[model samples]
Target: MNASELQDIIAWMIDGARSAPTPPQMMAECSERLVRAGLPIWRVGVFVRTLHPEIYGRSFFWTHGGRVETGTVDHKILDSPEFAVSPLAPVFRQGVEVRARFDDPASARFPIVEDLRAEGATDYVAVPLINTDGFVNASTWTTRQPGGFTEEQLSAIRSIAVPLARYIEIVTLRRTASLLLDTYVGNRAGEKILGGQIRRGHADTMDAAIWLSDLRGFTALSDRLPAETVVEILNLYFDCQVSAIRANGGEVLKFMGDGLLAVFPVDDYVGDEAEVCSRVLEAARESRAGVKALQFPNGDDVERFRFGVALHLGRVLYGNIGGGDRLDFTCIGPAVNLAARLEKIASRLGRTVVASERFAGICDGGWSDLGEFPVAGFSRAARVYGLHDEISAAAN
Candidate 1:
């Protein structure tokens, strides 16, 4: 292909990537670009082996039609080293200018090509896709046609390698983000119900105030609606709740089936007790206020939330805690338990905001006369107060 034609193809691939619905679409578009560039047999994709090595699982993989048929690679190549892997067994052993024309059966470079050749492929070219971190995602390529991929073809392919690498990175990040969220949400629920501590895999321990919230009348509401509708409503509700929690500088740890747990670390502890109290209160009120705006398909209003917000300055263990097969991201301590209990108290007392006296004592306004009461598991009557305003409230 001429310079202008190559440039046009590159531009097309970039534009297609921007609008592609899925990563595989981007790959397919790229393969098409290679074919138009005069390379035959366009098949491309990414592959990752399992971390356990023993599991030898394909943690992730995606492909576009280049040389191999859409799904013909089959089950065998999945776990076996027969297919290309990263760095240690990358297609481009050295730089991007790699060529294997002899179709050397003994050549270590294109091990998988031999398998494909045995299955009918005679010649092909594979270019390694490497991240900035030097992690090899996979190779992009063209299958055997006439004279195989030339040095000029490798150069042309190199020009667009970074963009293709970015595409792989996007897929990797999305998968990672999804897995992290699942583990985070799962662990939070586990801790809430199991009564133990679980720390996040990322951070060591965060010194922050935790918040627990539950929906009012969710049980009755679920009973009234079909199971699908119930799930839809709950998902919508949590979407808003999770959004609010993150918006207010807190991480949503878990959703307790009908409730949620969040925290504002004292590490980022922006203000004093009053400041923390105000922020936490504002987040709670916003969460509650947002619920009223949600509507279901049946036209019924969404359920409201009654938050039992307890902001205590204390140490809490935060991490994964579960069987070896499963891990959970959550916080555990007397403080988290106390916060949950406070939420229940708030519901019963008909108070919109209920907090421990320990938190109240350090802050400033918006408190009312709920007085002191003996908490269920605690030996003493913990001092508790109801919040009238989101901010400008004292804890004592």
Candidate 2:
């Protein structure tokens, strides 16, 4: 590895590498480029600390013959014993490079070193890639070449470390912003905000299948349980609803106490009315089963939780709305309110799932007319329908 070769690699790190779309793809390409440039690399990885609620960081691993493996480290793993002995532990904590020669028994006594040895790796090196914010990210390079990597090969890899850090930092920052936005707000909303739709009145109207659901007796349940226990119950309840909704192409918008609001956006051109409406109904059924099966080891107040869902299909206004500096990205329309009222009616009728006339008409069979009622905010009585099987189960 000559100075000219190292310079060429650095030039690519600064220019050509950034052309890759994502960090994981960029890492895989970088590894391939290095291998083509005469580096005896086996397994290489890049790990960056990220700002996220459930994840501590993200990782991209590239092996000589394997596909690029992307993974995440959860916050819980930061305190795990496995992470304590990994080479990254020292590199990130001390901002120093760690090298272990597997051929030498006296090398660093990390479990990862032994694992690499078993996998035919003779050398392992973990280097710190410090971001502009002074936060330390990490990268690891391993070689299965006989007697490990030569000093020139190691230095050549290190020569590009600075530019590599800069490139990685840029990509990581973009990813962090996306992860945080997607975590706090839903994906659809995050994309809107990212696309510069941050104004208070900028809105998008779409024909959508609206879903509104709530726990049957959440207030009484909260009153009876400890605050922490109540919150735990709420988490469990939402987990059931969120999973079902996302699985069925529904975007969860907001969680107001025990109530959840989500929508299945229909295609404006081709129109996915039947598809979207059926999916929303399927999601409601799945959510109901999930809540019913919620298990509490104590056999306490949460042994058999019950919930109700109201499905409606109509056009909704989705955008930012608030006063002054603070705003909320939400959906609002007569459709949403009608769904809310149907949810209350579902409670009164002892039905697990109810749907407005429009939603019921889009969906196939299995719905029974629950009759018309004088809805609060409307001029005329609104007709509602309930799932026939659920009504029979209630009677039983």
Decoy 1 TM-score against native = 0.52
Report lDDT (Cα) of residue 210, candidate 1.
Answer: 73
Each candidate structure's TM-score, on Cα atoms with residue i matched to residue i, is 0.52, 0.89
- Estimate the TM-score for candidate 2: 0.89
User: Tens digit of lDDT per residue, candidate 1, span 136-252?
Assistant: 655545445455666676677677776776666656665554454445564334434344333335324556667877776688777778988888878887876677766666777
Least lDDT summed over 10 consecutive residues: which range in candidate 1?
53-62
Q: Count the backbone clashes (under 3 Å) in each candidate.
A: 28, 0
lDDT value, residue 116 of candidate 1: 54
lDDT of each: 0.60, 0.85
